[model samples]
Target chain A: EAEVAQSPRYKITEKSQAVAFWCDPISGHATLYWYRQILGQGPELLVQFQDESVVDDSQLPKDRFSAERLKGVDSTLKIQPAELGDSAMYLCASSFGRGTEAFFGQGTRLTVV
Target chain B: ELKVEQNPLFLSMQEGKNYTIYCNYSTTSDRLYWYRQDPGKSLESLFVLLSNGAVKQEGRLMASLDTKARLSTLHITAAVHDLSATYFCANWVGSNYKLTFGKGTLLTVNP
Candidate 1:
């Protein structure tokens, strides 16, 4: 079955350093999402993209976080000057369309030291 | 803002037993989803409840949704070791299609 693909399964970075994560959604999927899961909490939406355009990013901290889906196929999430609290699992998911079931990727675990 | 709440944050049940996980959301939504996650792993989609009174089942798991009540449930039957995992309930906010998830219930099935 086709699945969302994420790169850098694990990342460890020093506080204040820059780090980036990549995600490639399943083919033909028009909606993509990036979520952050804390150690013992649920995943929270960081950003949502629809065909290369950002639909919502209310929860994203613009001061240090940025995400983009350049070609509407794959996406990249970056953190500049990462903070200690930024340690979490970054998950990428995709769906064929809005309000459809989303399939999640393996996710990238980031640990800020 | 939409908020999702789940009860019984941790559960320990014996094999062959049955139990249910409850999810309540703060706002009205027609779409609810259930997902499972193993330790140190990503999420696996379980069920999608699209309408009020919609119920779906697979294997030993059944999920139901009540859009009016803003509630969803995940029922596990004949629990087994393989069924042990963290389950989450997510609500889809309409306009942006953003999902707001609950804290999750960590279930441990003892054999």
Candidate 2:
């Protein structure tokens, strides 16, 4: 089975610093997603991409968070000037198409000190 | 906005028991998914219900969806300690591929 890949399994940084997470989806997948998960809550969607184009970014904090899937394959999520509230597990998922089944990456655990 | 909510945010049960977790959505949807997550880990897909009256089961867990009622249920049969984890139900609403996740049901099975 093809698995979604994510980089920097763990990250620790001071508040107001910059941090970036990378994800490589399963081959042939055309839809990608980014989610933020707090300790005890469900993951919330931060962004969604279809063939390198963003379909939803309503939940993303545009002021500090940015994401791009240039080739509609590998994608990246960056957070500049990270705040304490930004400390959470950032997860990446992808599917062959919208409303299709998706596979999730292990995630990048971010700690903002 | 589509809202997903699960009942009994937390649950504790003994091994060999049975329990069901409810997932309710405020709006209509195309499909529903059940995922399991361990502490500090990524989500593991468990089940996906595609249409009304759809039911799928794996191991001791069974999930059913009712699109008309806008609800889904995950039932555990003879739960085991290994089943202890947080389970979330997410739904696909409208044109977005984004899934709205329920708060999750934390199941703790004591041996």
Per-residue alpha-carbon lDDT of candidate 2 for residues B15-45, written as tens digits (9 for 90 to 100): 9999999999986775899999999999999
lDDT digits (tens) for residues A6-103 of candidate 1: 99999999999999999999999999999999988899999999999999999899999999999999999999989999999999999998888899
lDDT by residue for model 1 (B9-96), tens: 9999999999999999987788899999999899999998888999999999999998888889999999999999999999877577
Each candidate structure's TM-score, on Cα atoms with residue i matched to residue i, is: 0.96, 0.98
Q: Per-residue error at B11 for model 2, in Å?
A: 0.5
Docking tier of model 1: it is high
Pairs in steric clash, model 2: none
Worst 10 residues of 1 chain B by lDDT: B91-100
For model 1, which pairs clash? none
Clashes of 2: 0
